[model samples]
Target chain A: MPKYLLIMRGTDESNAAMMAGIDEMIATTRQFIDEMVKAGVLLAAEGLDDPRQGVVVDFSAETPVVTDGPYGETKELFGGFFMLDVASKQEAVEWAKRVPVARGAKIEIRRVPGSDEVPQA
Target chain B: MGTVDVEAVWRIESARIVAALTRFTGDFCLAEDAAQEAVAEALVSWPVTAPVNPGGWLMATARRRAIDAIRRSVALRDRYPLLTADTPPASEPDPDRIDDDLLALMFISCHPVLSPESRVALTLRVVGGLSSEEIARALLVSVPTVQARITRGKKTIAAARIPFELPVADERRERVGGVLTVLYVIFTEGSTATSGDRLVRPGVAYEAIRLARTLAALLPDEPEVHGLLALCELTAARFPARTGPDGSPVLLEDQDRRLWDVSAVRRGLAALARASTRGLGPYGLQAMIAATHAAASSVETTDWERIVVLYEALGRVAPSPVVDLNRAVAVAMATGPERALAIVDELTVSGRLAGSHLVPTVRGELLARLGRRPEARAELELAARLCTNRRERSVLLQKAAGLG
Candidate 1:
């Protein structure tokens, strides 16, 4: 079973929509999670704290330049992620299609590389 | 040799053999299945032709089984080419790797990737050398459920690439907590079933004790491990008298003191002494509480004040609504029902334990002691309605009816 990380990114509009019906959003998300759990594909899922509580540390400068919260020019902010055990990237995307996020939000599916895949010395 | 002797030998050696195989193959499920195959072979051949070195024979047999399995499965061969690179060994597994292998096996069995239930089932199956049926009986789950959990647990560990080795010192501290929690949950389930017809399942409880002993041996300097062992020993010492002839629950106050296991009490005291070398952890504190209960000849003579103090410390260290409810019970014993009732009411107002039957049950007892009959009856009835365990529910109902 290859584990896939489903990263949820939210736009400003999506964030506003999420805040409007937070309870219903949470209920819908819980139902989708329950479905995945029953199917035995869901490994872990957790929502990130609000974007305002986050920080970005850019190391492109000689010394790292630390910026607080979301960047002023930010369009899509990574909001949360779910780790699922599935066969392929397509299967991972199939599961991601069920996420109950607002319309403007986007999900990026990526496989989590296992420790065994690392080149040994 | 008798079946008991064979089982005893297998239990003692299974973890070491499987651990070594897993390290060699880097496949947990294959190692466990090979170990099982070797044990099955032992059952057939051991009685007919007893080997001089039984443990070594089992190891070699299991190694061969692993090779045979890899050869049989194309998927496994492609995935674990390293395992099939060499021919099966004729000699025993390397003795030098036994200790580290055992420790790594413990870590792997209790890896954080698996759910708590999965960890318990896998640990008992691999480390404790229990069959799926035995685990199902111990946990009161269906055999299929246990099998599914074990399979999924192994798949999850392999999928997550959880390494088969002891973690670094800093990481070990956090990881060991998860291991200890699994052991504690197993002991608790065995001591007092969460929801079952029986109050105590000796087999499960005894298995937890055995696993704890192995863990304590492997990690001798860890105080919390010894603390957990001491707690299990002290609590299990009272198991002999925890039920009546008809198998009904015998409350601590009502139990016959003569039936207590004196040897277990002595062992618990020794382990507690070792745990006290450092400051008491949560398990150490709980062991102290159990030791206090064991020391008293009767419930009236039990040091309720000390228990109350212990619960206070426990509340600070491991704060939970259950702890508060327990502290209220201790207050009732140490002081008066009036003081206890006040504490219970405060807990109710906080709403931390709103839906649990324990809150109402304790409230009912305190109210009954304070001569508030109607309120006590209602509370006890509510507890009865909420309880799921048939025996416990019947007792609550009896108490409610008696209040009227």
Candidate 2:
């Protein structure tokens, strides 16, 4: 079965706005998680720490460059995610649509194929 | 061999190679023996100097070993397709058309001549490509016991002269159930243990699912094949919630449905749809029952009427005391306790499930629901005494205490 990582991203302004109303957002999100749990689709749900506390390593240069977060030129902060083992991308999209987030936040759903998907020699 | 993952490659390719060997050599025992010998030799050498092509290396080595063994066997009795020590057998069989060989291996492993234990062990070893140690640990049996069963199973096939070919049409339809039954038993062992502290044997359960998927691919037209797959997948979807954090059994009503695997539910539903095309078989009916619970928001909201109907259908297809008992439970939930009690009372009178705690336990629950406190408490107490599993006994004891 394939697993999907529902990545909810927002700009710093959006993040701050959501945090300002964090209690209600948290309540709605918990309700959303409860729905997923009842449907038996939720594998895990976790929130990311402040992006300022995160680090970024750049390998594009010959020597690796390690930069502390609030990474430069970063458009959106990739926040918390809900990992679900669901049937299709469409199903994942439906679940993602129900995520409670700030107005400016965007969610990206990525599928993780099984290790068996790698072709053998 | 520089850090080659020999075990992983063997896990994926072992069945195909062994199946092909059996087809070419026309000797099931020799083919399996040779394949193991090849893997054993690779395990010794691969870590130090890995093969450029691991699967190919194993295949060539196994064929060589089979030829050598045939030479020695020729001194006693003639075995066809005998080759000289240095020669490769006439020509390589095409691997593309190897599904028949796999199906044949499955049938032979689950041959009626062998005992149930042997069938499970043999299927895990050959078809599932599991190590004896892995099988033993998953099954809670000793490695020697697993090895003995595999060895005895192969001997039985030889003695019974089970042909290395798929059973003919009529026989194939009849015997596929025997093969599916072996996989089902293995899956049941992993998903639900009757006794012991371990509530779930994930390794065995996952292996059974992998094998079932393989069978479904091999016999795409067989509805029961998909039925077993659906049944296993749907039942396994609840595994995450089946046990609590402390590894204690969680009853169905108390389980957190949010913990179910959504992808597994989808997989099961798809398989169930395929199963229904030919009408619900025994496993399909069970899968339907599982799906009802999977889709339900809670016990109160569960479609008990539909479950009762499904169980009734299951009773007709695979009539057993357990099925009848399950139907009665559904009946109790759907309508009332009186009718369910009548069914349990009939079972009690028949003595078909004499030593099993299940009958008394169900009867106790129904009795409690009917407000027969004294009798319900007594039945639960008797059930607690009869139950061999510690966890189950604890639940029964709790029920009896609740009645009191």
Candidate 3:
């Protein structure tokens, strides 16, 4: 079976500086998506809402509290996501190499959890 | 009737037929010489028969002639298993087999071993089937220049002992990029001539476009090839509107969109769709950027912000000063002229584009937009002086005059 999702985050500071311009960021992302699709590796890809629009829900307590914008102290945040079907971790890694990320943005690769074991919102 | 005329016609058809004959005979020089001899025969016989299948006839005669030559030469007596064993296979080979030959020939003609000038000359000679004089006229260069480039290009290929066969898949990807780049460069030069008396060289541009389209068809699965074809089609669409009645350069903003070639645009869009299927690489990304402009009805309606983004992506994939300059232009249109000017200022200060007319021309535009007429006028004048293209220089002068 092919690995479905390879989660990635911007890992380098230089890459972060490169993304200073939003127009350039979007253009690069779209191009990456276009290439992935043509290669038959891309199922779907999307850039997330701005960090300010992101809402993190905490379910650790009885009552879940939601916080917005720069929600946590984690240096690496999910800026965008892509769902791909590739042969192995190596193939997924190869695709990751082509992503247009900021110089220092971290790309964390993780397998998508099955529905039964999905992380709760 | 003249020797050069015969040589010219032979050059046009030689590469393709030679490639096909090579596959048949499995001898490179023999295939080449036999093809040359067949052309000589055609020079005498064509005037009389003028056969419908000249290429086919040449292939047939060349195969037979190659066998005859090999038989007469003592040096090749031991290696005559394939040629002497059989009555040469029918000259009219399957089209599928010939496609491979043509593809290999195209790759060879546009090989990276040759310089850009040499690549273009060889491509025109071998693929576009153009004579040296024709290429000379089309490029506005001396015939001797074209002749010398082709001579050196062929000699280099021979010296390198480059196999005249289609590369394997892995190697194809790497090598194909060079071929595509050469064609793209040719099309760009013809479309917006770097330094020339005329604004456009339709013949050269058309030939490049034709070759690109052929390559795209030959390799349908290669996204970059389709992307290149899309870029050519989209860019060529504007040729009709890129100049005025007196052949003066028409700024993109002032061009009449209605005059654009709609069919070419449509074809470009279709090719872009194919390109998109494979995911955009540098050429595909650039084509997508061009498609953004082609999609808009007018300059104001163009998605400059998207273009800026595409250029940035292109920069990452293919880092070049030219891409950065273009991205800056897009930034100016998307954000503010001031921001664009700042970027241009940095680029200039860094000496990345020190002598390029683009730096001053872009700076002048931004300055003009910011209401700095005097500064803008001076920059435009500087740009005009730096520019060697008559059409572009005239446009810069007009902008300067308007500023005053």
Candidates' interface RMSDs, in order? Answer: 21.9, 13.5, 22.0
Candidate 1 residue A111 C-alpha distance from true site, Å = 57
**TM-scores for all predictions:** 0.73, 0.76, 0.71
Across residues B1-404, which tens digit of lDDT does each residue of candidate 2 receive? 13566666666567877888887778899999999999999989987887776767888899889878877886423654444434453255443456678888889888888999999998988887778998898788899999999999989988887889888888887789999999999999888776677777666777788788778877878998889989988988888788776777789999888878777888899989998998989999999999999999899999999999999899999999999999999999999999999999999999999989999999999999889999999999999899877777888899899986
lDDT per residue (tens digit) for residues B239-276 in model 3: 87888878898888898888777767887898899998
Better of 2 and 3 by TM-score: 2
Comparing 2 with 3 on lDDT, the higher-scoring candidate is 2
What is candidate 1's CA lDDT for residue B120?
96
- What C-alpha lDDT, on a 0 to 100 scale, does residue B289 get in candidate 3? 90
| DockQ value of candidate 3 | 0.01
Which stretches of model 3 miss by more than 4 angstroms? Answer: A1-121, B1-15, B25-37, B64-81, B84-92
Question: Per-residue lDDT for B214 in model 1?
Answer: 71
DockQ of each: 0.01, 0.03, 0.01
> Chain A TM-score per candidate?
0.88, 0.86, 0.76
Reference contacts preserved by each model: 0.00, 0.00, 0.00
What is candidate 3's lDDT per residue for A29-120, written digit by digit as tens? 78667545433345457765556667889898899988876566545666677776443454465566567776667565656432213353
Our tally of clashes for model 3 stands at: 25
Error of 3 at A84 (Å): 41
Per-residue lDDT for B200-288 in model 1, tens only? Answer: 87668877877787777667799998899899989988987887777788889998877787767887898899898988889999999
Q: Candidate 1: give the TM-score of chain A.
A: 0.88
Candidate 2: clashing pairs of residues: A37-B258, A38-B258, A40-B260, B1-B48, B1-B49, B1-B50
Query: For model 2, what TM-score is found for chain B?
Result: 0.95
